[model samples]
Target: MRSTLMDIAREAGVSTATVDRVLNNREGVRERTRQAVLETARKLGYVTPPDEEGGNANAPVRLDFVLPAGTNTFIANLLDQLVTQAGAQDGMDVHVHSIEGFNPDSLARQLDALTGTTQGVGVLALDHPTVREAMRKLAASGVPIVTLVSDILHVPRLGYVGIDNRAAGRLAGYLLGRLLGKGAKRKIALFAGSLSYRGHEEREMGFRHVIAEEFQDLEVVELREIRDDRQRAFEETAALLKRHPDLSGIYNIGAGNAGIGQALQEAGFAQSVIFVGHELTERTKRFLLDGTMDAVIDQNPRVEAREALAMLKNTVLGRRFDYHPPRLQVIFRENIPEF
Candidate 1:
């Protein structure tokens, strides 16, 4: 059994109030009594939790950061940046977690469990109704949630910390059109981690809108959902290419770059296909350097880490701060950043 203040008081022959003062180091009791109480607490293993002056301060802020599990280099890099930020920020006590694939049911359950104990949360959640409801309950209790890489619509939140994915998709469409440049009738296919993600869906919408209005010759097939698995991506990509030999381009708004690269190479279409994908990971960087990929849409993870931690700190501290959207960086073979 663990010890309590009353137990410490009983063992030391002192009042609970004196024990409280001594535990808080508030100063009032005589030095002899203070020393005795301290020694008793030490012997009893009574750890003093930091005082809640502003609720999550005197110590680090306890935040639950939930991500999806996979070899998605973009997410992996983002996770590393966040872990570094957690170590650097004395105000941020982040506990990182990962759920398998695009399972919103599990994500919702985890969100519900984080209430009442953790001060805040960060997530790359599916835009599902149950997940939103769970977030609503937590928000009602003043537990701030900041959605990273994706945003849930019509729900209260600290803020969304990512690029305008719609704009990215539109740019992707334009880039594809420019690369193919008045080529013979073209067919393009789009891939996604999952349309359940608002970011990926928005990207799809923007891609479709641009292809329809600006590039009529570029025809897009229905979206292929990979669930961010490399094997799934490899199989689906191989099947799609075999099914459509005339496929001119591909835009994977999600991830699994290695799978995409492998399928393209094995199918003997890496040189012929016009590819545009998101994020600047080592795999994608190699593709760009080797001329396997044409362009990459990168969201700067360092800036994201700094902004996300700041947003969580302000929200927990109840301070008003301006929210600015991070810029979307486009990389070409000629301008790849140092690996």
Candidate 2:
């Protein structure tokens, strides 16, 4: 007697619907399950469907979204968006990993381990020699990587999904100079989470370049690294006020705006100093409302998350997608977003 689909289902320990799908080369069946059904049919002298030879076309592309462990509101929100998007996509399985302590060595290890299995990865990169080299090697070995807010140049990543950091910095400088006025020479302070962050460095370059070309009178006294810690930011801002009593402006290139705002408030310089920072977090929003923070340069993380996913999906599917850079927002008190 000729073997039937029911024979394959019962012998292979699967439902009749599953055996039917595998026999007819339909999707929604896992590779292992399909293979098992195929092997069972062969043993039972059942004719295998010719369509099954091409393999599963609708298999989920397994991916990993690597995020740094931090309290940066923008990054935190970006991770959330990516997870939500992954859950909604039928053809993708995404696992979000937040590396503890953000040690590049640890990140590289995790990435190297995923080389064989993962289809693609999206990273909020830190600019370090080993980290860049590891990513480059991974991409060379067939795994594609895309950098998010903080990018790296060493690796030929699928693309970067963030604002033009230099332009953002230039805008900050322009706002600072405009708000500071041209009547008198004033000192400016630059605060960043770390100079090692390519985003921060790029912003600093653009800010300084613009300040030099357009507002020569506004002196940039120093670039302070507060490690993205609120206490450090508060201490640094307070120290900056003490050191540069005549400081007219401050531009923060990273998180910890809460500390920046509080320090300015306690020092009795909140209204006097022109304060500009990055991201539109609740902390910054409150500062903007209370007149502590004058301006915010927001790099929309939600938009970035969507863009990254679209671009990466195309890459995985071996297709092309248009790469459009997102415009950085220069927000003020009156233009605060409803969200």
The models' CA-based lDDT, in order, is: 0.83, 0.82
**Candidate 2 ranges beyond 4 A from true positions:** 1-58, 100-102
**Distance from true location, Cα of 236 in model 1, Å:** 0.7
Best candidate per TM-score, number? 1
Q: List the residue pairs that clash in candidate 1.
A: none
Q: For each candidate, how many residue pairs have backbone atoms clashing (under 3 Å)?
A: 0, 0
Mind giving the per-residue lDDT tens digits that candidate 2 earns over 85-201?
778877888888888524779888877877777777898777888788888767755566889888898575766889989889999999998988887677999999887789999
The predictions' CA RMSDs to the true structure, in order, are: 11.6, 11.4
Q: Compose the digit string of candidate 1's lDDT tens values, residues 234-323.
A: 999999998999899999989977798889999899999988998998888899988789999999887777778777776555344556
Q: Native-vs-model 1 lDDT?
A: 0.83
lDDT of 2 at 183: 73
